[model samples]
Target: MTADATKRLCDVVLDETIGRATPDVEHERAVAIFDLLEENSFAPVGHDKGPYKLALSLVDSKLVFSITGEKGEPVATHILSLTPFRRIVKDYFMICESYYEAIRSSSPSQIEAIDMGRRGVHNEGSQTLKDRLEGKIDIDFDTARRLFTLVCVLHWRG
Candidate 1:
């Protein structure tokens, strides 16, 4: 995304009720939070203003995105089904595992090949998320990519 369209996130939080996450999941969440806050585009529908705070969690079997103003007032909430993302997320996790394993002992060329595949899967997940949130929330490709990773981290429990 261009610098002009970027909207910084004041903070990002995950529901503790989701239970403890694995180290890998925690690392994904941490990087997403850091990168998302550093640069992102998140403007709730009908509200052109931003510098928002986002809280992510699973409610029942749905993914919930709770958005609030920088001061903590409610902005909007979007809940999405996991059905549409199942395939891509599953593939992403599988490829991630392969990438990690490959990095441990594979040749540099092999590792690069796996990394490329991992990035491809990640891009697919990001595009799917962007499509799913089409009218509800407006986010750029980079923002969607990072958000997708966080969603995958949450979905690890499922």
Candidate 2:
């Protein structure tokens, strides 16, 4: 782990509405949260340091990333509109579906190809999120990728 990632997340609270998510979505959330807690870099611009607790939710169609200090003091709230992420998220979902299906019957080479496409989409989402959170918070690529996965889980309400 990088020095920047030394201060990891101590707690996370996803919106209750997000709990009814599909098994895949729930799995994504679980894995991301687990990995994020194991290691991550989360530094909010111009704020006190963390071990932060994040409360993620959607309000008025906007995704909210609400962060607080370890003791739960309000640190910052970054609300992002889903417009810019629409294309990448849609593509990611499509590829993930195909990737999952491929795992059930496809050959190793075919599965590898689909997995590569899935990773590409995942990277796209991660980069977009990193850009969107640029000024408000500074997060490393790994953190951004995990965050993106969690965001996709929130978007999976169907």
Q: What is the C-alpha RMSD of each candidate to the true structure, in Å?
A: 2.5, 2.2
Superpose all Cα atoms of candidate 1 onto the true structure and report the RMSD in Å to 1 decimal: 2.5
Candidate 1 lDDT by residue in tens digits, 1-158: 33654255778998875567778877766886887777688887788667788888777778888999888889999998888888998999899899999989999999999999999999999999999999999888998998887778777753
Q: Indicate the residue-level lDDT of 22 in model 2.
A: 75
lDDT of 2 by residue, 1-158 (tens): 44753255677888764456677767777887887777777878886477788888778778888898988889889898888988998999899899999999999999999999899999999999999999998888998998888777767754
Instruction: Show pairs that collide, candidate 2.
Output: none
Tell me each candidate's TM-score: 0.87, 0.87
Cα deviation in Å at residue 100, candidate 2? 1.9
lDDT of 1: 0.83
Give the distance in Å from residue 82's predicted Cα in candidate 1 to where it truly belongs. Answer: 1.5
Evaluate residue 40 in candidate 1 and report its C-alpha lDDT on the 0 to 100 scale.
80
